[model samples]
Target: MRLLHLGNVMMDLVLTVPALPERGGDVVATGSRSAPGGGFNVMAAAARQGLPVTYAGAHGSGPFGDRARAALREEGIDVLLAPRPERDTGFVVCLVDAEGERTFVTSPGAEATLRPTDLAQLRPEREDLVYLSGYGLLYEANRAALTAWVPQLDPAVTLIVDPGPLVRDIPADALQLLMARADWWSCNAREAALHTKIDDPAAAAGALRSRLKRGSALVRTGPDGCLLHHDGTLDVIPGFAVRPVDLNGAGDAHTGVFMAALAHGLAPAAAARRANAAAAMAVTVAGPATAPGADALDAFLRQSRPAPR
Candidate 1:
């Protein structure tokens, strides 16, 4: 199965501290690392899971772009970067605390310059799955292109949508339109609540499931676990307890693993379980794109005895 990930590919500079600092307070960072970001994290994780993955995005002609592409290549992800000579690659500065919570300061850079015409360059086969992140739809140009391209996609191609942390900024109608077109919808508890206007993650996920055209709704509830609504049933999957070093891209890892498992013919519940294990492993590392391979992930799953729903 070939997975096509569409969104920003960025260089992420992460600083890990023992604790998060208060407003206007100074703290020393204990660790620092650079990795990929946005949908690149997901694509890399999927590739690590042994999925055939292709990435579509814009990377500039700069040192950061070189690092980004190199990181992707190391993970064995096929890159389809837009050729832009004058722009610099996008990047973000992320601060992570001991508890794995993070704060991001971003510069869109070349990613912001992606135009509608770029969408025409993507030519995935009918069997490929397209995974789109919310950040891509946040910008007017990319959003317009996505809006125009979604309906034209081959019906055999599965579309998975992750609203990520930016769904609150999207118009309700646009959100609905994307939901209607998606084959699967995944979001964290906060994003799910914001999208459905429900404070409870499970209720919000259930509500969103009803609103979807032909897909299930999954809400990731941090350490408490995750809840999924599919085919008129709700399954509560427990999250594993791990000493997290960084939580920056855990969600992205989860989403990627879930999509990869699905592409490999796993049931939705089994895929969610696999993804949950992958995410548990991700938080144990320091970088945003630190996803475990299939062997490591399988061992983690074997040790994690998830609670029965």
Candidate 2:
């Protein structure tokens, strides 16, 4: 089964600062780098697990777009849409403080627009895993196109939704439409709280999972790990503790690895286990695209296993 990503991929300008400055204050960054971020992190994480991935999102024509396109190609992910002319891809200015937390300021570009014809070009096969992000719903064009197209998907195809940080901003009707067809829902603590109005991650997972017709819900709880609700059972998958260098893309890493593992036939609980490991590993690194490959993930899991009694 292939993984199809119908989300936005954009450029990320990351600046490492000692701490985020207060409003009207100034602070110089200690380091900086630019790379493909946003949905790119999820796709890249899945690709590293040997998943055959396709990016069916809009790209732009300028340097940022060019770089994002190149990065996708280099990662062996197929880009289905040609770059939109005269427009650059959108970008996020990521400010990372000493605690590994990041705040983003985004500028939407070509990636924000989606036409009806763009949706027509997608043809998901049986058992194919299709991913949609809350970011996609932030734009009227993309939101309309995706929500209208979702309910029409074949039963054989699986839909995964990750209602991101902007979950609260998405229209209720659109959010309901997407969730109605979602077969898997993966999100973090804040996002879960926003969607379910439950402050506890495990309880939030249970509430969300109850709404699914035939699917599961995963609520990632940072250092405490994740809660997976599947087949009427809720399992708390413990996290791997580590000193986080940067928390950017950690949730995406968990989502991508979880989907990839599920597509490869692992049980929901097992998939959550691997996803937890992937998230832990991602935060230990300092970059946004730090998802581990299969070999690295395997080795990390092996070493993290408990010793024999």
Candidate 3:
């Protein structure tokens, strides 16, 4: 089954700085680069693992949009929607600190202007995986369109929802709706706490899993890997050790590889194990699309020892 991502994929303007500047202060970046970010990371990660993927998001007719489309094509992902010639694609200004932590500021453009007509063109088949993100839900136009369309998806279709860093900012009703419909709800430790009000990752995962209708819950614990709760059992899928140079797309790598593994018929825990490896590999690189390809991932997994359970 193909993976259908209905999330926003925009340009990323990444700045490498020693530290974040103080209020009303400025800091010069040591280095910088631009790339297709946001949902592009996940799609790239999945495609690298041999998943046939499609991007059904808003793109614009400008430099950023051109780069995004080109990047997707380079990764072998299908672009399902045409560019909305009215405005340019949006971009995120990412500041990566010495400790590999990142902070972001967004200037949304065409990606925020999703319409009902765009949503109508999507046609997901049974067993096809559909992905949604909290970033999309944060925009009014995208939120309105997606909330109206998601519930109507075929029940046989698998829904993967990533609450993202802006999880707390999403409206409560919309959050509930997406969570209820998700076949796989993947989020990081902080997002799990925000969504469930439980500080412990395992406890938060348990609470999240209880809300799913017929799906599983995953709480990614950064370098410690992730907790996968399915079939009434919680499994701790361990992570590999690495000196992280950039942590921007680590979660996206984890989620992408996890979904790809599932698409390849791996069990939840087994899929998470591979995802853990992908995330570990992502952070060791210095960009937003650092996920490893299938052969590279296999090589990494073969060389690394599993973490003690």
Candidate 4:
């Protein structure tokens, strides 16, 4: 099965700073780098693992858009849409703190301008693994189009939704409808807490699953690995421990890798274990989306023992 990533290509300016600046204050970056980020990270993570991925979002014409498109080409990901001239490609200023945590300020660009017609060309197919980002679904320019098209997807398609950090910002009706149709849901601990209002990851997963008629809940809990809930049981998938230098796209990396594994018939618990290993490898590098390739990832897993049954 092929993975179809529905989102925008973005340029992430990752900066390592001792501390984030407050109002009327400034903190110089200790280190900085520009790379592919945002939803692009997710697609790259999957593609790096040799997953066939098609980007179903709009690319734009500008410095940011040019590089974004070029990066995808470099990663062997297919661009399924034409570039938009009206809006530029999106960019993010990601401030990674000493603890490897990141804060982002983003500008939604061409990614947000995806009209309903743009999605029509890439209709959902049976056995297709579709990735949907809440960041894109909530944008005003994309919301109506996405909402109108969500129910049209084939029931056989596996739709995974990651609400990102703005889970609370999406309208209740829209969020509910998407969750009902989504076959799987993945998000970080903070995002899970925000939407479910449950502090415990297991509880949060349970609450999140209550909305979906068919799907499992996967919550990435940083070094603690991820919590996977399916059929009323929660399993904690342990991850590797490495002192991270940057944590810009950790969740995206996990989502991509996990999707790749799932598309290949791996169970949720097993897929999450591999994803955890992939994400841990990503944070060890300066780039957020620098997950290991298929061979490298397999090697990493071989070095580690199998997830406990």
Best by lDDT: 3
The per-prediction CA RMSD against the true structure, in angstroms, equals 2.5, 2.1, 1.5, 2.1
Better of 1 and 3 by TM-score: 3
Q: Count of backbone clashes for each model?
A: 0, 0, 0, 0
Residues 181-260 of candidate 2: C-alpha lDDT, one tens digit per residue: 88998899889999899998889999999877777898988877888888888888888877888777799899999999
TM-scores for all predictions: 0.90, 0.94, 0.95, 0.93
The CA lDDT of each predicted structure is 0.83, 0.90, 0.92, 0.85
**Candidate 1 similarity to native, TM-score:** 0.90
**Best first by lDDT, ranked:** 3, 2, 4, 1
- Model 3, 113-224: lDDT tens per residue? 9888998999899978999999999999999999999989999899999988789899989998987789999999999998889999999999999988778999999888
Span of ten consecutive residues with least summed lDDT in model 4:
300-309
The numbered model that scores best in TM-score is 3
Against the true structure, candidate 2 reaches a TM-score of 0.94
Give model 2's clash tally: 0
TM-score of 4: 0.93
**Model 2, residue pairs in steric clash:** none
Query: Which candidate order results from sorting by TM-score in descending order?
Result: 3, 2, 4, 1
Over 1-309, each residue of candidate 1 has an lDDT whose tens digit, in order, gives: 699887788888889899877899999999998877777889988998889998777678889888888888888888876557898788898887887677889888776666657778887787788998888877777777788888788878889999978789886667888888888899999998888899988799989999998888889987666888988899998888888876767998899999899988899889998888888889899667777899999888877776444
Better of 3 and 4 by lDDT: 3
